[model samples]
Target: MKRLCKKRELISMDLTPLIDVVFLLLIFFIVASEFKKNETILNLSLPNSASKENIVEKKAIVIELSEKKLAYKTSEIDFVQLEQKLSLLQKDSQLTVKIDKEVKYKRVVKLLDILNKLQLSNLLLITKSQ
Candidate 1:
């Protein structure tokens, strides 16, 4: 009598290798991205939260304001000078304003108004957490 042959499984796929490749790519992006380029001059005491996403990949020219003075990047610049530089730079009007916690609110508002007057469309305000 002839013995019956066992049927083999037709469909089979390995996910382990694919998962490993994805994991490696994730790690590569994390490592390749730079978190900070220069010593962030903005004394923005950023408000803390339960969770905060790391600001990476998106590099923006930093502008800082303090009760003591106003500045672009690290260099101290007057409002007129700032405007001139802004025009010269001719970069995106969108800018980030890093303000000290102790600074007056009116000052911040005034800054926003000036940015608007300059037609700067985007403004990011910085604040500190209690």
Candidate 2:
């Protein structure tokens, strides 16, 4: 018989696994990106300060003073329970105060005095810039 020559062939890589991994990563990032959008809005206005550091407000004792009466959070509170209320609030976490513009300055000062007596050092007064 005459001599016969066989041709050699190179193998190619399978792309099925690589394609599957790419699809999984795309789905994961899409889900994560959607969750970054915030849902609720805080209607209150905040003034700018020279210090650019961020101050996080975890919780606060809102004192809304209208022309009618003084209210803490939602309910009206007398000076007697003011200390107890603040103490109770302090037991769980830190707090700040959000006072309205129309509120009397004297009332705010009195509350500050009480807070000092309770030994609560950190106090933030919320106000709008004119």
Candidate 3:
């Protein structure tokens, strides 16, 4: 008499589906994220405004000003350098100024003066809603 032999099949899991799911999730998150280049660099307390007008901003240049620091976009610079940068922009370019509430009036005036000399008339001063 002869004894019969048994054979077992090897089991394996396909990781391709798992990898695809992870890749899709990564792509979804990347597309949904908002990247702010300059706004988060400085802490500012904007003054309150009583006016109810809501300004809808299109593509515009951003200038952040604090008591001790002035930033063009995200890079910290002095008034002279800021002026030079502003001069290169078009006269009608929309400029958005975000100044700290604690900043002195003199500094605000100085910035306004630079904008005036450059003849950049399209200006928007950002403030908090009361």
Cα distance off (Å), candidate 1, residue 110: 2.5
Index of the highest-lDDT prediction: 3
Off by over 4 Å in 3: 1-19, 22-40
| RMSD after CA superposition, every candidate | 9.1, 7.6, 3.9
Colliding residue pairs in candidate 1? 47-129
| Order of the predicted models by lDDT, top scorer first | 3, 1, 2
Off by over 4 Å in 1: 1-37, 42-44, 48-59, 89-93, 127-130
Tell me the spans in candidate 2 whose CA falls farther than 4 Å from its real position: 1-54, 66-68, 91-93
TM-score (C-alpha) between model 3 and the true structure: 0.76
lDDT tens digits by residue: candidate 3, 1-130: 8988877878899999999999999999999998765453469999999888657575778898999999987788999999999999998899989999999999999999999999999998889998
Candidate maximizing TM-score: 3
What is the alpha-carbon lDDT of model 3 when measured against the actual structure? Answer: 0.89
| Model 2 quality (TM-score) | 0.47
TM-score of each: 0.53, 0.47, 0.76
Tens digits of lDDT, candidate 1, 45-66:
5544454443522545567877
